[model samples]
Target: METSKVIVEHIFLLVIVTLFSVLQNAFFAVKLEREGKGGNATAFERVSCAVRNCMDAYPTFLAVMWCAGLCVSQGPAAFAGILYLVVRQKYFVGYMGQTSQSTPGFMFGKRPIFFLILMCMVGILNYLLGHFYGRCYKAQLETLTSVVAALLLIP
Candidate 1:
C-alpha cells in the first residue's frame, strides 16, 4: 500500500482509540458517581487525572507517529500506535482500580513512544549520513537502521 494511505489508516485508528479512552474515562466517572463515591473528591480527582494524562500525551504521540510513518516504515509506526492504545487502556483500567496497579501499564505504554522517538532520530541520522557520505553508504545505513529499530522491541 502507498505510504499516504497507510498513514491515513493509522490516523483513523488513533482517532478511534482516542475516543475509546475518553469514553472509558467517562464511564469511570459515571460509575463513581452512581456508587456515591463522587462525593469523595479524591475519586473524581483520580479519574480526571487519568483522563488528563492521556490528553497530555496524545499530541506528542500523534506527532511521533507521523514522523515515524513518513520517515521510517508505516507498518511499524501503526504497530506502535496500536500498542499505545492497548497499554493506555490497560493503564486507565488499572489507575481506576488502584494507583499501584497502574505502574506496569504506564511503563509498558512508554516503550512504543520511546521506540518511535528513536526511529525518528535514526531516520534523521540516516538522511544526514546519506547526504554527507554519498549514496554508497545509504544502503548499508538503511539495513543497520532497521536492525537498530527492531532491537528496540526486544525485552
Candidate 2:
C-alpha cells in the first residue's frame, strides 16, 4: 500500500479508537456514578483509576505512533498501534472486572509501544547515517524489522 494511504488509514483507525474510548469512558463514568449513589464507592474509584491509567499512556502512544509512522514505516506503525489499543482495551476491561486480571493485557500492550519506540530510533538512525555518512542501512533495518516481526508475531 502507498505510504499516504497507510498513514491516512492509521489516522482514521486512531480516530475511531479514540472515539470509542471516549464513549466507553463516558458510559463507565455514568454507570459508576449511579453505583456510587447506591453506596458503591469502590466501583466509582475503579472506573476512575482505569480511566486515569489509560489516559496516562495516551500521549506516549500517540508520540511513538506518529514518530514510527513518519520516520520508519506506516504499515508496521499502524499494526502496532492497533495491537496496543486492543490490548489496552483488554487491560481496561480486565481492570474494571478484576484488577489482577489486567496484568497480562497491561504487559502485552507495552510491547507494541516498545516496538514503536525501537522503530522510531532505528528510523532516525537510518536517516542520520544515510544523510551524514552516505551509508545506507536499509538491509540492516530490514533484518532487524524481520526479527522483531517474528518475535512479536506481527504477521
Candidate 3:
C-alpha cells in the first residue's frame, strides 16, 4: 500500500478512538445527572479524573500512533490504537463502578501505551542511526515530524 493510504487508514482509526473517548465522557456526564450526582462535586471527581487522564494521554497517543504507523509497523500500530480505546473504555467503566476495580483496566490501558511509546522511541532511534550511517533518513524523519506537528495543531 502507498504511504499516504496507510497514513489515512491510521488516521481514521485514531478518529474512531477519539470518538470513543468522547463517548466515554458523555456517558459519565449522563451517569452523573441520572444518578443525581451532578450536584455532588465528590461524585463527579472520579469521572473528572478519568476525563483528565484521557486528555493528558491523548497527544502522546497520537504522536506514538503516527510514528509507529510510519516508521515501525502499521498493522501493530493500528492494533495498539484499537487496544488503547478498548482498555480505556474498560478503565472508564470500571472507575465508574469502583475506584479499586479500575486498577486492572488502568494497567491494561497503560501497558499498550507504554509499548507504543517504546515503539516510537525505537523507530526514531533507528532513523537516527540510519542517518548517521549515511542513509536517507532525513526525509522520512521530516515527513513524520510534519505529520505529528499537524496532528498536534489540530484542536
Candidate 4:
C-alpha cells in the first residue's frame, strides 16, 4: 500500500510493456523472413502497424500515469497503469487479427488514461486551493480516491 511499492510496480509494468513491444517486433521480423517475404510490403504490415501504434502512445501514457502517481495517488495510478498495459496488449493482438476488432480494446484502454489525467487535474486543484487559501483538500481527495479505487477493486 505504500507509495514506493506502487511505483516499483509501475516501473515493472513499464519494463514488461516495453519488452512485449520489442519482442513482438522481433517475432514479426522473424516470421517475415521465414515466409520468404524480404523487403517490400507484406502481410506483416498489420503486425508492424499495431506495434507502432502502441509505442506511439507510450509516452503520453507514461506521463499521465507518473503525474497521477506522484501528484495524486499511487494506488489508483498503479491500477490505471496496469489496466492500460493490459488493454494495450489486447489492442495489439486484436489489431493484428482485424483492425475493427481493435476498437473495443482502444475504447477500454483510454479510460485509464483519462482517469489519470483527471486525477492530475484534481491533484493540481487540490494543491492550488491549499497553497493559495489554506483550504487543503488532501484528506478529502484521498478519501474519495480510496473509495473509488475500492469500488474498482484497484488493489
Candidate 5:
C-alpha cells in the first residue's frame, strides 16, 4: 500500500484540499451587513447560506469514500465527490476575494490553475484507485496539484 500512488493522492486531498477549503471557506463567509429597512440580510445570513449550499461533506462522506475505495471498491467515487467539493470551496473563496485588474489574471490564471489542479487530482486518483491500478494516464493533474499545493504553502 505504501507504494500506491492512489493512496498518496487521496491523503494529499484529505489534508491539503480539506484544510485549504475550510480555512478559505471560513475566510470566505459572505455577509450582507445591511439592516432590513425593507429587503436585506446580514453577513451572517449570507454565510449561513453558503454553509448550507456546501456539498454536505464531513466525517461521513469523505471518510466513507476513502474507506470504500480501500475496503470495498466504490470508495473512489466518494473520494471524487469530496474532491470536487473541496475544489469548489477554493473557487468560492477565490471568487469572493478578487479585485478588478486582477480579474483576468485571477480568472484566466488562478481560477484555471485551481480548477485544473483539484480536478486532475480528483480524476486521476479516482481512475487509479477505481480501475487503472497504475497504467499511467498523462498525470498532468498530479503535477498541477503538487505544484500548486507547494506554491500555496509558500510564504
Candidate 6:
C-alpha cells in the first residue's frame, strides 16, 4: 500500500503529465500565432484541441493508477509516474519542431535537437505497459510491469 503522502505525490505526477502536455500545446500556440499573423484567437484555438484531450483523459488515467497502486504498492507504480513526467517533457519539446540559425526560443529555452529518441522509446514502452498492466492483478500483468521496472533500473 502506497502511503497517503506518496499517493498524493503520485497525483502530482499526473498533474505533471498534464502540465507537460499543456506546455507542448502552448509551444504549438506560438507556432500557430506566427502562422496566423499574430492572431491570439487562432493560436488559442489551435492549442486547445490537444490540451482538451489530455484534460479529458486525466480522470480515467488516474483511476487506473489508483488501482495499480492499491494492488502492488507505490514502488512499482511510481516507476511509471516518473516515466510519464520525464518523457512527456521531452516529447513536448520535440513536437515543437526544429530550432535554427535565425529565430530561437519559441518558449524562451535553448535545447538540442533529436535528443529525445531514447526518452521517447522508453516513454512509449512505459505508457503501453502501464496502461495494460496497471489496471489489473493477473500474473502476466505483474510480470510485465516487473520486467519493465527492472529494465528501467538498469544503467
Span of ten consecutive residues with least summed lDDT in model 3: 146-155
Q: RMSD, model 1, all Cα superposed? A: 4.7
TM-score of each: 0.68, 0.74, 0.66, 0.72, 0.32, 0.40
Candidate 3 clash pair list: none
Candidate 5: lDDT of 102?
A: 28
lDDT of each: 0.69, 0.75, 0.67, 0.72, 0.44, 0.44
lDDT (10s digit) by residue, model 3, range 1-155: 69988668756655665566567667766765654555766657776776667668877877787676667656566667777777777777787777888887787777667767766886778778877885645456545544543342122
Candidate that beats the other on lDDT, 3 or 6, i.e. the better one: 3
Question: Candidate 5: worst 10 consecutive residues by lDDT?
Answer: 29-38
Best of the candidates, lDDT: 2
Candidate 6's residue-wise lDDT over 1-155, tens digit each? 56988667745544554455457557655655564575566444544443443345445444544445434433444455455434434433443342231132212111111112222333445556678887433445456555655564332
- Superposed model 2: Cα runs more than 4 Å off: 1-39, 138-147
Ranking by lDDT: 2, 4, 1, 3, 6, 5
Candidate 3 residue runs with Cα over 4 Å from true position: 1-37, 134-155
The digit string of per-residue lDDT tens for model 1 on 20-112 reads 655755765575565455477766667667777877897888788767655665556666777777788788778877888889889988988
Candidate 2 per-residue lDDT, tens place, 130-155, comes to 99999878667756665675566542
Report how far residue 98 has shifted in candidate 2, in Å: 1.7
Those runs of model 5 whose alpha carbons end farther than 4 Å from true positions after fitting are: 1-10, 29-44, 72-83, 90-155
Scored against the true structure, residue 80 in model 2 reaches a CA lDDT of 76
Superposed Cα deviation of residue 28, candidate 1 (Å): 8.7
Candidate 3 scores a C-alpha RMSD against the true structure in Å of 8.5
The positional error of residue 100 in candidate 5, measured at the CA in angstroms, is 25
Q: Which stretches of candidate 1 lie over 4 Å from their true place?
A: 1-40, 136-155
RMSDs, each prediction?
4.7, 4.2, 8.5, 5.2, 9.3, 10.3
